[model samples]
Target: PLGMVMGSCVYHIAHQRMGAKIGNIGRNVEIEQFTQALYDARELAMSRMQAEAEALHAEGIVGVQLRQHSHTWGSHTTEFFAIGTAVRPLRDNHIIERPTMVLSLDS
Candidate 1:
């Protein structure tokens, strides 16, 4: 096959606590509040990913994706999903060993 990238997609789950108890059979009453909570949680997760990338001085992220869903069954919560690869510029140097600052997932 030609050159192609096979990526490992990771899922990050975000949870939000509405604080209020889930009323019996009345999701409609709290739908708006629940939605806002989920939004806040997802933003938190995104901020974390960006901070991590900056710490590594990545040029950009590729194959990034996100998802959201509410917890079910015994869990009883909402979740946000995010995934991406942190990348940096590659410079061809005569040095055989990469510098200590080089970011490599295999390391």
Candidate 2:
């Protein structure tokens, strides 16, 4: 059986110091917290999608698509969505065989 599975997560970005003043010049650096928040949000969404697939008794999921969007929510808030097709094997304990290599005599 083949079915569709999906999951989503929402996160809010927090305010952080934009720059550090050194004497007279200001230096800007990457915001570690913001990067971490993005990673967390994506993981949460993927996990939720996987759980849904498990509930469907699916052996695996394919064609996974991850997306991010912000609707209605303010600029600081973003939503992460993960979707995939869940598929169940036709037979239990099925064995997959590797393909044999063939060589051409003429080249």
Candidate 3:
């Protein structure tokens, strides 16, 4: 069976901070809370994904993809998702063939 794993996290900005940002119209302001939330969510998602791979006794994970979604929870809420496929060593001193491209001298 293919060892596929995934992790998810949900985050929301504080109502007070949202209201404050709404009051500011044209001014360029950086919302630290929102930024922190994004960082935290991403870290949590990655850690959870790694934990899942560990549970599967996998040596490593490949093809990792991270995604975010707002859904119907409005603009203040966001969800972070991480997905990857876990893999293990096939055999001792085994070489895997990979596709390669060679330049043609005729060109």
Candidate 4:
């Protein structure tokens, strides 16, 4: 049976020093906190989606998509959503077909 699986996560990130703060003044500075928060959110969402697939006894998931939403959640908060289709193998042993090409000597 084919099933649809979904997982969602909401996270609140603290504000970090931005441009022209007190002692920080740069053109483009990377914010480690924000990066880590996004990474964590993605991982959490993925794990949850995998768990849902397992509940359905699916072999694997296909067409996975990860999306971000900030619906009136303010600047410091964001939401992550993951969705996919769970599928089971038709048989124990399945073989994939590969295409072959032949070259001609005549130019």
| Candidate 1 residue lDDT tens string, 31-99 | 555556666777766776666677667655555677766546425465666667776656645333343
Q: Estimate the lDDT of model 3.
A: 0.82
Please give the lDDT score for candidate 1. Answer: 0.55
Give me the displacement of residue 100 in model 4, in angstroms: 18
Alpha carbon lDDT of residue 10, candidate 2? 95
- Where is the poorest 10-residue window by lDDT in model 2? 17-26
Candidate 3 on 1-107: residue-level lDDT in tens? Answer: 24999999988865555668677778887777788888998998989999999999877778889999887857788889999998777886764454367989995
Q: Candidate 2, which segments miss by more than 4 Å at Cα?
A: 17-28, 95-107
lDDT of 4 at 47: 92
Q: Is candidate 1 or candidate 4 better by lDDT?
A: 4
Query: In candidate 1, where is summed lDDT lowest over 10 consecutive residues?
Result: 1-10
Expressed as tens digits, the lDDT of each residue in 16-96 for candidate 2 is 644532422554666677788889999999999999999998877777899998767577778999999987767778743
Give the Cα error of residue 42 in candidate 3, in Å.
0.9
Model 2 Cα shift for residue 107 (angstroms) = 26
Instruction: Report residue 57 deviation for candidate 4 (angstroms).
Output: 1.5
lDDT of 2 at 107: 85
Instruction: Using lDDT as the measure, name the better of candidate 1 and candidate 2.
Output: 2
Alpha-carbon TM-score of each model against the true structure: 0.50, 0.74, 0.74, 0.77
List of clashing residue pairs for candidate 1: 14-80, 71-77
- RMSD in order of candidates: 12.8, 7.1, 6.2, 7.1
How well is each residue in 5-100 modelled by candidate 4, as lDDT tens digits?
Answer: 988899887787654354456447667888999999888998999999999998778878999987684878889999999888788796323435
